[model samples]
Target: MAIRGYHAHLYFDPHEVGHARAVAEAAQAAFGCPVGHFHTAPVGPHPRGSVQLSLRPEQFAQFAAWASEGREGLTVFAHGLSGDDLADHTQYVIWFGTSEPLDLSIFG
Candidate 1:
């Protein structure tokens, strides 16, 4: 089966929080979707400052394409929300740039 929706985690360095925020905001504008909190510290198992956006499957391909335009050096970690957190974050995810270490045990 195809994916239902996705959660895109936009990770950034400490000094680039603003840039990340702008990227998230631009994504919201470009896609007309909701952008989640801009986190300075690790949220749950995430290893860096991150912002999240939930995208329906219909929106995924376009969003991924737009993101590949190199939205100012942000590392995008996107995964499907298939009711299986572990697999979603691990096996079914797409990484645009370096992947960060996540404390996946939280999903247990």
Candidate 2:
């Protein structure tokens, strides 16, 4: 199936929220993507604090490249939006740093 878009969740610890915010804001300012709320606690399946950056498919490569270097030690959980949350989080994902275990039970 064709990807609809993408969501890149930048995960950070409570102490690293400031770093996460800077990365998210830089991404938004550079790519003009929509940055979601900075959650200081784990929400949904995310294992830690996170901020989501919604990006178009066309923006993925550039964003991913930029994030790989610009993330400043943050763990970025990025995936394709293909209308299947389970598969999107598992099969169609990439990571910039150490990957975290998501609560996939929420999908089932």
Candidate 2 local lDDT, residue 100: 92
How far is 91's C-alpha from truth in model 1 (Å)? 1.3
**Residue-level lDDT tens digits of model 1 in 1-108:** 456899999998788898998888899999987998888988887899888999998999999999887466788999998887788888889988888899898988
Report clash pairs, candidate 2: none
Residue-level lDDT tens digits of model 2 in 1-108: 999999999999899988889998899999999989999999988999999999999999999889889888899999999999999999999999999999999998
Off by over 4 Å in 1: none
Stretches of candidate 2 exceeding 4 Å from the true structure: none
Candidate 2, overall lDDT?
A: 0.93
Q: Which one is best on lDDT?
A: 2
